[model samples]
Each structure stands twice: as structure tokens, then as C-alpha cells.
Target: MKRFSLNQATTRHWPMPDLVAGCVRAGVTGVGLWRENVQEYGVERSAALVRDAGLTVTSLCRGGFFQEPTWWDENRRAIDEAAALGAGTLVLVSGGLPPGSRDIDAARAHVGTAIGTLVPYALEAGVRLAIEPLHPMFSSDRCVVSTLKQALDLAAPYPHRAVGVAIDTYHLWWDDTVWEQIARAGREQRIACFQVADWLTPLPAGVLLGRGLPGTGCVELRRFREAVDAAGYAGPIEVEVFAEDVWSRPGDEVLAEALAGYRDHVAGPG
Candidate 1:
């Protein structure tokens, strides 16, 4: 059976119970959560709430932002939190280019160094690290990892070694090299995670990360699924829509609509 996981951002205003409840209402079997929510609700209780509702936590996002010289302590704590949630993959958003640095190469180096530093800690915690590649537009401020290929390239040396890429369509949809990269990540055993939401226009500056429901935008859903599955991936297809507009509505409505959109756009015609 195919499983869907609720991305915590979809119900940003709700408590963890409410978020997991929304997923239950939508018939989704899994949930992917951000660290802030865990901090707010407390990991043990949050994990209990989801499990009580019978939800599978696909991943715990995230554990990066290594630009700070003193960030390791905080990141290690995040790994411990993921362990509490029983989430196997801890997504990492290698944060932005540091100030006074026009050089993207320097930022990329930071990401590599950060991951190399964190991988062992994660493995010891029995959790994997998934490096998420943000869109190129976010290169200067949000995440330095920008392509599945780029992320795979970085983690290739560490294959099956508890570090890999988080395959999110919102960031990689426009990449001309997606197919090749997905194949490479698969062959190399590097697809640590998978997620989706569509891309829309006129996105507010801070919410450029806000993505539309899957199948509503330009992503070729069936082809995307085929490529991932072809590479032998059968993980949860996490719904990670981050729209401010959607969040303003009632949580149940947003979840129902996102699930319906996924069904109509992805599971229906194709």
C-alpha cells in the first residue's frame, strides 16, 4: 500500500495532536515533522500522540544550519529528539551562505563539513541524515544544497553509510538533471527521503519555500513516481506543502484538500 505523510508545516498553527488528527482524517498513514513542533509539544508526548493515532513518522526534519561555529551542540540535541520520535531519517537543511561571502563554494564546503561531522553522531543514534537540497533561488539564504545530483555528489563518498539526499520535488522540479540524478542516487543507494508539493507564482519573499499541493503545479507526477520507484524506492511520499494562504484556513480543510489534490492530480488520471 502507498503511504502518505503529513508535513508538519501544513498545519502550522495546530498542536501536534491536531496535526496528526488531520492526517488521520485524510486517511494518511504517516507524518513528517519539523523540530520546532517537537520542541513545542515535547518529543515523548508528541511521539505518543502520533502512535496513539496509529501514524507512521516518516522523518524528523531537521538537523543542520551549521553556519554557526557553535552549532554542533544544538544539532546533537536534534539527533536525540529524532531518536525519541523513532524517526529513521533526520533531514538536514545545510543552511545559507554566510555573510560577507559571495562565494557559494565556501557555503557548500560548510555543508560538507557539517554533514561529515554529524554523520557519526546520527549513526550512533540509529537515525540517518538526509541532506535536503533547497532551490537555487534560496542558495544565498535558505539552503546551500541545490540539486539531487549535487546532494548525491556530496554524500556519494558516504553511501549506505547513514547519509543521503532528501528528494523533495518543490526544490528540484526545475532541475534539468533530475532524472539522471534520481537514477544515480538510487543506484548509489542515496535516496534517504522523498517529498512533494507543487510550485506556484508570486510567492512572498520569506515564503518562497511555500509550495502548492502536489499535482497542482508543473511536476509530472507519474513520471516522477516512476523514476523513484524504478530505482527501487518505496518510501512514503511525504506531502510538504508550506503555503501561508493554506495555513490560514482550518487544518482539516487544508489536509483534505491537499490529499484530494494528490489523488486527483497524481493517482487519478495517470
Candidate 2:
């Protein structure tokens, strides 16, 4: 329960104030926020609200879409927002290949270069950039960096403090090599964030929202948790499910279920 964090995406429709109050009531000391929600609620107001409630902003949702022409300006703004919100980490979703181009290698290289450009700004803002590798299914349109190894390779050139990796179970659960990579991340001190979500069969039509709460699907949730712990990552474990059914319920109910799942499956005695 101590390291549990309810990522804002788990309850997408809940208002910021209501979400903060519900987390406080549930004794959840940490939360992972989304840029859209923070901007809509006003960054300063959101910051103060969470601070006054004694909640920690575990990590901000995203700052990378290097394919966009405005990537520089947009990421800079994201860094500023994270700084104002007192978030120590900003997750980066390396965008997919450019239109009419299928060079995945080049896209990944661009992502590395882009992060290198932002290292100075991110360091100055006191926020770490966590490169998140989405599931390979999203390689064509969402994120070209599809494996933990690829994310690590991209981060290798930068200092761990300025650049690291976000390990999400939903994305990396299918890889047998992930265990070794997890250890490498810890050894290199590049584990900026750790998120949990189950992989469900009969994926939803909109694959992006196909994630399940911990213990609800086939992922070896406890094994992943123990592996990260053994790898020396003592950070918040954020449950970042993106299911429509979960989002349709009341925020409090969803939060309770998430906590139960985490306790029984991810954080329980091994």
C-alpha cells in the first residue's frame, strides 16, 4: 500500500479535485498525472491542490512525440509543466515513424537525438525524462521504440539523471528477455518509473484502451514486482489501466479495486 499510486488515466473522467480527495480518503499517498488534466485544471492550482492534500505527483504522463515538427517547443513546455507541478519524472512516448516512411531504425535514432537535445532543459527543470516503450502493436502509429532494450539503448548516451526508462508491464510482459533488461536498468540506474497493467485477451477495438487492472488478466504481476524489487528499484508502482469498463465506474470504487488488485497480486507476500 505504501508504494501504490493511482495513475490519473485509470479514472480518466474523474475531476482533478475529486480524484485528489478520493486518493486522500483511500490513503493513497502518490498519483501519476496526465498533462491534459493538469493543463485543464491549471498547473499551479493542481500543484497546490495535490501539495495541500499531502500527495506526491509520482510522474507526469508524457513529453515525447519527436515526430511532430513542434517537438522541441512542446517538450520544453512539458518540462516546464512538470517543474511547476513538482513532478520528478516526465514519461516520454517516442512517437512512431513519419508519414510515408517505414524506416523504424531512423525513427528510433531520431528519438535518441531528440532526447539528447532536451537533456539540458530537463536537467535544469529538475525533471527526469523516462522513455516509455509501448507494445510492438503500436509500432506503426504510436511508438516505434517497442522493447525495453530499445528504450535503454536510446537512454545509454545520456546521464541517468537526465534520461531513463519507464517499465510498464503491459508493454514488456511478452518479452522473455525483459528480466535481464530489468536488472540492467537497475544496474545502470535508469529506472525512472515502474507502472503495472494486465494484458487482456480479446483486446478492445481501440487497442489503446485495452489494458486491465492488475490481477485481472494473464500477466505475471507479482513476478514483475519482485523482479523490479530485486533489481533495486524502490519507487512508486503506478497502476495505469486504460480500460473503458474501469473508467465507467465511480472513482472511489475503481480506486478500491485497484488497491485490492495491487495488494493481492503485485505487492502481496511472495
Candidate 3:
């Protein structure tokens, strides 16, 4: 229960103030935030709001997209925002190949080098860059770091406290070797965060908003929780769903349902 965190995406349209209140009322002490919303509501003000509500900012949604022209400046700003919000982790979504280019290996190499360039700033700002490997389905457009192994490899050159991997159930659930990789991540102290979003079939057109709630899809939610716990990770377990149906509902109602799902499927006997 202490590890449970409400990823703001679960209630995508919820206003920042309302989201904070809902989390408090639902006994949620941690939250994973997105950059746009924080910027819209004002980063310092939002940070103050969460602090006043006694909530912890577990991890900020994103700080990577190396393919973009303005990636360096954008990521630097992201790290500053996370630091301002008191979030120790800044999740990185390594962007895909550059436009009109088919060099995937080159794109991956660029991501690693890009992260290296940001290490000094990350360490100065006291934020750990948590590289998140999105699903292979997004490999062409969203992310090239499509496996936990690849993410860990990219983070290996830096100090674990400065660079780590973000483990998400939706992306890694299909891999048979994930358990071993989780163990390896723990051994290297490279696990910076953990996110949960069940996998549903017949993905939507963009495939970005197809995630289901815990216990509402095929992923073994408890298995992932147990595996991470076994690997000595006791960080926030963020429930991040990106579904039109989930977001269409009232934010409070969604928060309640998410908490229930966490208790049933993710908060099993330790």
C-alpha cells in the first residue's frame, strides 16, 4: 500500500488540483506526473500543491525523445522540473529513428550517447534518468529502447543513482526473459521506477491508449509485483492506464477503481 502511486495518466483529463485531491482522499500518497499538465498548471505551483497535500512525486512522466531537434534543451528543462517537484526519478522514453531514416542501430546508439550527455546535469539536479522501454509496437515511432535489457545496457555506463531503468508491466510482460532481467536490474541497482498497466487485445489505431486496468487484462499483475519485490525493489508501483474509457469517467471514480485493482491483483501476500 505504501508503494502504490497514481500515475496521472490514469485520469488523463483530470485537472491537476482535482487529481491531487482525489489522490489524497483515496489514500494515495504517491503520484507519477506528466510534463504538459505540470506546465499547464505551473510547475512550482503544482509542486506546492502536492507538497501541501502531503503527496510524494514518485516520477515525472517523460524526459527523453532523442530524435527531436530540441531534445537536449527539452530534456534539461524536464530534469529541472522534476527536481523542483521533488521527484527523484525522471522517466525517459527514448525516441525512435530519425525521420526518413531506417538506421535503428544508429538511433539506439544516439540514445545512449544522448543520455551520457545529460548525466552531468542529472547528477547536478539530483534526478535519476529512468530509461523506459516502450513496447516493440512503438519501436518505429515512439521508442527504440524496446526491452529491459536494452534500457539497462544504455544505463550501464553511468552511476546507478544517476541513470536507471523504468520497469513497466505492459511493455515487458510478453518477454519470457523479463524475470531474469529484473534480477539483473536489481543487481546493478538500475531500477529507478515501476509502472503498471494491463495489456488488452485489439489495440487501438495509435496503440497508445489501449492499456487496461490491473486484473482487467492478460498480464499477471501479481507476478510482476512479486518479481520486482523479490529483486529488492520497494519503490512506488504506479498504475498508469491510457484508455479513452478510463479517462472518460470521473477522476475520483477511476482512482477508486485503480486502488481496488491494486489491492486485489498487485498487492498480494509478500
Candidate 4:
């Protein structure tokens, strides 16, 4: 059986050093990172800390807003940061149409072009870009890739080793075509990362997280696992919960719940 792990969710309360320490203490095999945390801790320092703590950096949480003119600089910088952090996968959350622009199709085109531009740099740094399709509700502002189909298209140009799509259950579980996408990802050899967090009650803010507890929420992680296993994706299945209520708890308690939840409900027998 493969192992699942907690991301920086436990370390959100502490600095990067403390967070890495917490991850080691919690017995997770891997971790995820955000740009803010990396910036605060400095890439070299954060990388050293995480390595010293003996953790795998599963992914860097972002890169891809191809919207307004300002987005170019920001996205490039994010890509640079991901490379510096030694993360193989850079989860891309594509940007929406600019203000006063009612063109979804145009925004989609921009996403394609942006990825094309970044792919060479990503390859140079040994990073694989993993396009993430947020829920449709976030189409206007957060991400233009509102479906796995769209993300797959964005990843099509590059070979699977260079480009892939992220499979986040919280974002994809609602899709009718998730199974097909998983199959396609497998066919393309592009299942970069499999992340989990269930959907809860009324979504708070609804863009970035709105994450829920596993099993308690509505997603069928067992089905997701079956699809992934069938697809031959043997990477670590990351537990990424972004609930405000959950983050408010003491770091250890939050990690305990997350780890136990994954063990009992996600990674266990279905």
C-alpha cells in the first residue's frame, strides 16, 4: 500500500522552519508550499529547513495567472520561486479575463500562450508544470481552467514529463468527466499530483480553499483512489485542507486529525 501525507496545513501557523519541524514531528512523508511562506523564509533557508527535516516538497501551490499585463511578471516570478525551491511540480491556477473584458475564450487563449511561454523555462529548471482547474465558480477571477478538459488541453503541447495536470479532489470531484480525465492523464503519463480535501457546507469566500474534512464532506476519495491506482500514478497522495476552522486549531491537533482522516478514510480499504 502507498502512503498519504499532510501538506503545510499543519505548518500554516508557524514559520517555515517550525512548519518543517512540525511536519517531521507529525510523521508525514511529504509537504506542499505556498509562495508567501517561501518568500518569508527565503528560498534557500526554507529549502534547507525542509530538507533537514527530511520531507519531500510535493508542489509549489501556484503559477499561471495569465490575465492582465501585470500577471506576466508575477507568474514568471512564481515559476522562478518554484524552481528555486526544488519542487518538481508547479500547480498552475490560470487567471480569468481582465476587468471590462467579457471574453472567456480569449482568457483561455491567454492561458495557452502563457503556458507555452513558461514551459521552456520550467523544463530548464527541471520543473513540471501541473495545470489546475478550479471549480467553475472561480472562473471569473481565480482560474480560467474550470475543467480538467481545459487543463489537459493546456498541458497538451509539452510531453508528459514536462507538463501535467494536478488532480485535486476538492476541485474535480464535482465534475462528471473526472474519471475520463484521470484515464486521459494516465494515457498521457501526466498525472502530476493527487491532492485531497472534501467539500463542506456553505463555501466561505470560495476561491482558494473552502476545503472540508475527509469522509465528513461529500467527495468519494475511494473512487478517486481507484481511478488513480488504475492509472498507475504511484506518487504521494497529499492531504491539503484549507478550512479556516481547521487551521485555527493547534498545529499538532490539526495534523493529527488530517493524518488519521487520511489513514482511516482515504488510504484504507474502500
State the weakest 10-residue window (summed lDDT) of model 4: 1-10
Q: Which portions of model 1 show Cα errors greater than 4 Å?
A: 205-209
lDDT of 2: 0.96
Q: Which prediction has the highest TM-score against the true structure?
A: 2
lDDT (C-alpha) at residue 181 in model 1:
90
lDDT-wise, the better of 2 and 4 is 2
What tens digits encode model 1's per-residue C-alpha lDDT throughout 1-270?
Answer: 256677887778878888887777767888899999988888899889888888888999888877766679988988898888888888988888787788888888778877788878888999888999988888877788888877887786664658988998888888889999999888888887888788777565766756888766777766776788888788888878787887888989888887887677655557
What lDDT tens digits, residue by residue, belong to model 4 across residues 1-270?
236666675346766776677777767768889888888778888888777777888899878777867767787787788777778888888888788898899899888888888777778888888998888888998788888888888789877888899998998998999999899889889899888888886678744657876776889987898899898898888888887678787777777777777877788897
lDDT string for model 3 (1-270, tens) is 889999999999999999999998888999999999999999999999999999999999899999999999999999999999999999999998899999999999999999999999999999999999998989888999999999999999999999999999999999998999999999999989999999888777757988998888889999999988889899899999999999999999998889888989899653
* Model 1 lDDT, residue 23, Cα: 75
Best by lDDT: 2
Tens digits of per-residue lDDT, candidate 2, 229-257, equal: 99899999999999999999999999999
Off by over 4 Å in 4: 9-11, 205-209
Candidates in order, TM-scores: namely 0.94, 0.99, 0.98, 0.94
The true-versus-predicted C-alpha distance at residue 47 of model 3, in Å, is 0.7
CA lDDT, every model vs. true structure: 0.82, 0.96, 0.94, 0.81
For candidate 4, the per-residue lDDT at 184 reads 88
